[model samples]
Target: MILHIDMDAFYASIEQRDHPEYRGKPVIVGGGNGRGVVSAASYEAREYGVHSAMPGRRAGQLCPHGIFVKGRHSHYAAVGRQVREIFSRYTPLVQPLSLDEAFLDVSGTLRLFGDAETIGRRIKAEIAEELELPASVGVAPRKFIAKIASDIDKPNGFVVVREDEIHSFLDPLPVERVWGVGKVGARRLHQLGFRTIADIRRYDESLLKSKLGAWGAHLWRLANGIDEREVIPDRNAKQISHERTFSEDQSDFEFLHSVVCFLCEQTAMRLRRHGRKAKSVGLKYRREDFRTFSKSKVLETPTDETAVIIRVATELLATMRQTEPRPVRLIGVSLSALVGADAPTQMSLFDDPGYVQAERRVDRVMDQLADRLGDSRIYRAGSHDWRKRPRE
Candidate 1:
């Protein structure tokens, strides 16, 4: 059996938990500026048609008096760790879908825990007691059904689909509820007169394949409640990247370089924390009109050193420079081609300069402090002015 746990309005809930005054009111968490988009919306805000990815200005138009708060990812991560700990008590086979959702294989522990439904209830209860947040749980014989069941009753709710009820429960659901069906996929399904999972199941497999290619065949199987995916554990990431959308388009080279340096340091710190090294560094920039460009270089040696990553990133950025300056709307840095610490290494004859080494040491100190005190606790000297000035 598989159990899917999904936290309800995770970010907004955290805000409400910390600030008692925000509870049961419309709240949106994201950029406070009028141009920013909503990162997460409370249930009250959702009732007003506000949701994640909606423009902050549009969200405000939907719920004029809605409270808005900037996201604190470090706080959310702390809560996520607490939730993971609670999940560990139930089964070690927990596979996190995100910081707020995960799938657990409880088939092996059924004898000890009684059944999937019982396990789901216990997990939900523990999360509520420990984190003081609401969660919804869905349990079924397969991952797809389990995920769907969990969404049926949300916000401190639990639902279980017995082996025999899988087909009946899934048949009536809209095609959008299927695993692979997004807006475009659903629209195609709708055009084919397949509005529900049962409709898709009624079509011939060959017809589905002919119409949608491999994806159609896969959707047919999913509609019939047949998911062969295993609940694999220890899914290590292949790359780590961070990007920030500026509140206003910027053309300042010094400011852009600072943001890139900070991102490089952040990615390098994450790689080192995972005991991994990267052989490639990449940079991405988006113009004011949203045209994006990226460049990457394969390093001669794999490294998790911040100074090396930042140097390579700076070099990559230089190649994209043009005579006509354009304002940047977003900036990003990423490291890829990862290898474990136990892997073999080749030494470089030319070592980094003293100043580069010093910068790396400073990055290490900042990383430790950020990990303990939080990301906002430390900032690059000039990056502070990128945002608004404080009243005090």
Candidate 2:
């Protein structure tokens, strides 16, 4: 059996939990800038048609009186860790889809835990007691049905699908409910008279393959609940990146450099938090016209040092300056080729030992300070004095 647990309005819930006055009211969590999109919407705000991915301005229009809070990602991550710890007690097979949702295979433990329904109830109860937040759980024989079932009764609800009920439960669901159906897929399915899972299941397999290519054949299997993906553990990330879209495009080099330093610091903090190091550093820039450019350099050794990343990113920016200087819209820093910190280091003879040692010491001090205080409590020196220019 598989159990799917999804936290209800995770980011907004955290905001409400931290601020008692925000309870029982519409809340949106995201950047306060006009260019920002809604990252999470509370159930109250969702009633007003506010949702994630909606433009922040549009969300404000939807709920004029809604409380908009700037996002605190570190807080959300802390809550996510607490949730993951709770899930770990039930089973070690937890596969987190994101910070707020995960899948757990509990087939072997059914006998020990009574039944799948009881397990779901216990998980929900544990989350509520430990975190003071509500969650929805779904239990089924397969991951596909379990994931969908979890969403059926959201906000502190549970649903259990018996083996015999899978077909009937899926039959009436819209094609969009299937795993791979996005707006494009839904439109195509609509044109093919396949409005529901049942319709797709009844369609000729060859015709589906011919019409939708490989995706159609894949969807045919999913419509019949034939997913075989396992509840994978240890889904270690391959890269860590941080990007910020400015509220207004500008040609200010000092301000853009400060932002790049801030992004590099954020990326390095994440790498240290995960006890990982990167072998490559990269920078991304978006011009006012939305044309994006990126440059990367392979480091002589893996590192999780902010200064080193910033130095390389600054070098990349110098190269970019050789071309026309258009107003900057966005800046990003990324670290890839990740490996565990405990892994052996392969350093070249030409590498500067003094610089490497200084970077390591700086990283350790920064990491300690961040762990004791908070990520935002400390930032790059240049970023501390950055001032946004007024719109023209």
Candidate 3:
């Protein structure tokens, strides 16, 4: 069986656990300023309609007494490692979706560990006992259903869907419950008189394919509980990327540029940590209407330098902007075509050795400072100011 485990309010819960006085109070992480977006919200704060990715200004209006805290990405990453270690104890066939959630296939270990339900319960209990954090778990024969089951009842929820109970469990749920069905996609589905998963299941697959192209057929299959995806373990890292969806659509050139710069910085940090360099860098742009575009640049030299990546990324972004200066809802940066850091460099004789060495030294120092303090404490100048400024 497949098991999906997700931490409950990971960032805010960590803040509350570390700060004794903040327990049971409304706690919101990130969104320290008007322009900032919330990273996470505790259940206490969620009662007032606060949530992640909501604009800080709106969150403040909703939860007037909400306690706002800056996010410490480095600290959170450390805690996430501990959580994964607990998962590793149970099974090696584990796949992490993010820092706060993962999937584990226990088919091999079921004979030794008991059924999927028992293993899920024990893992959940271990996390609570060891980390003092709440986790919701879901077990099913398929990946999509398992993920959906985990989220059905959150904040310490546990759900199990037997092979025979998949349809009964999924039928009544809203169309949005299906993965990749965002607000825009949901609205489109609803407009077509499809309000629930069952509605999609009852529709003609050929018609769906004709109307929505490949996505329609994809949704139809998922609605019928036909997901065949496996839990893929990240044993060998292939690509590194980071993306952000804003609380509101952003159009300002400078703000969006800063966002790219920040993402490139994060992507580069991971690349260096993995002892890798990239031969290609790419950018993903999603408009407010949910249309997406991508651009990539091939580099002559593979280097894990934030400056080089962002320079290539900005040029790509400018080209995309020229094509269509539409409001953006999401932006991302990625580095691929990875090679080991020890790989020989193909540098021109005119290339300055002094400058290259200086850049590497700077990256090492920044990474060290980030580890010693937190990612929130250290950042390049290009990304510092716009994160907190109100959109004009």
Candidate 4:
């Protein structure tokens, strides 16, 4: 059986767990102003129409009593490690999709663990008892169904879909419950008289395929409870990134430049944190009209250096202006073509021999300082103050 484990409102839940005053209150983790967007909102806030990715001002209007807090990504990373350690105890075939969610293939471990549902209960119990965190577990025979089942009932839910019951369990569920059926897809499916998975199952797959293209056949199989995807372990990331959406469009190049620097630093930090380096830097920006542009540059050497990342990202953003001056609603940086930190580099003979070493030292110091102090608390304004030695 496959097991999917998803934490309940991970960021906001962490905030509530750390701060006693935030418990039962609508906790929001992000800036609650026009300059920011919501990162996560507690279940309490969801009742008031607040959600992640929503504008902070709208979240505030929806839940006026919301308790807004800055996200401590370091804390979240630490907790994620703890959660991962718990998953490791059960099975080695674990694939983490994010810090708060993962898929575990327990087919081999079932013999030692009794059964799939038993293992799921034990795992959920351990998380709640040991870490005081609520986790929803879904155990099924397929990967996609397991993910969907885990989310079916959340915030301390456990659901087991037996092999014999997969069809019945899926039949009456709305067509929207199928993965990849977003707003537009759902509306189209509804217009085709597909209110439920059963309706989809009744339709001819070829007819549906002709109408929806290749995706229609995929949806038809899903409706009939057929998912062949495996839970492959060690699905290491191909890239690391960070992005931000503004409450209001930002037109100023100076301001956008600062945002790019911040995003580069954030992405580079994450790259290093994983003991990886990127050989390519990618930039993405969405205009006020919702049009998006993306560009990337491959580097001569893989690096997790903040300076190099920022320089390349800034250059990519500058290329967008050639089209026309446009206000940006969102901006992001991505680091790809990841390689191990120990990967050998052929440093330029023309460049200083100590250049790479100096850059690593600076990034290490900054990483430590950011962990000790908040990420936003420190900034490099063209100075070496961070390199100064303390009293002996």
Number of the predicted model whose TM-score against the real structure is largest: 3
Where does candidate 2 clash, by residue pair? Answer: none
Per-residue lDDT of 72-135 in model 2, one digit per residue for the tens? 7767878999999988887878887767999988877878887878888998998888788989
Q: Which candidate is the best by lDDT?
A: 3
Evaluate all candidate structures by whole-model CA lDDT and list the values in order. Answer: 0.80, 0.81, 0.87, 0.82
Candidate 4 residue-wise lDDT at 70: 86
The TM-score between candidate 4 and the true structure equals 0.70
Ranking by TM-score: 3, 4, 1, 2
Summarize candidate 1's per-residue lDDT along 1-392 as a digit string, tens digits: 99999999998999998999999999898745665567789998899998986767778788888998988777888899899898888788887776799999988888998888888888888888878899999999899888888888877778889889978998888999987455555666788899888998888999988877766788889988889987765336667788776656788787787778778767887777678889999998866544568889998878877778888997777677663368877789999898886666565667656755687588778877765554554666544543222210
What is the alpha-carbon lDDT for the whole of candidate 3?
A: 0.87
Candidate 3 wrong stretches, greater than 4 Å: 30-38, 53-61, 67-74, 244-256, 286-293, 320-331, 348-350, 369-378, 381-386, 389-392
Candidate 2 residues lying further than 4 Å off, grouped into runs, are 33-35, 235-339, 347-392
Superposed Cα deviation of residue 38, candidate 2 (Å): 2.1
Better of 2 and 3 by TM-score: 3
**Clash-forming residue pairs, model 1:** none
Decoy 1 TM-score against native: 0.70
TM-score of each: 0.70, 0.67, 0.83, 0.70
User: Which is the winner by TM-score between candidate 1 and candidate 4?
Assistant: 4
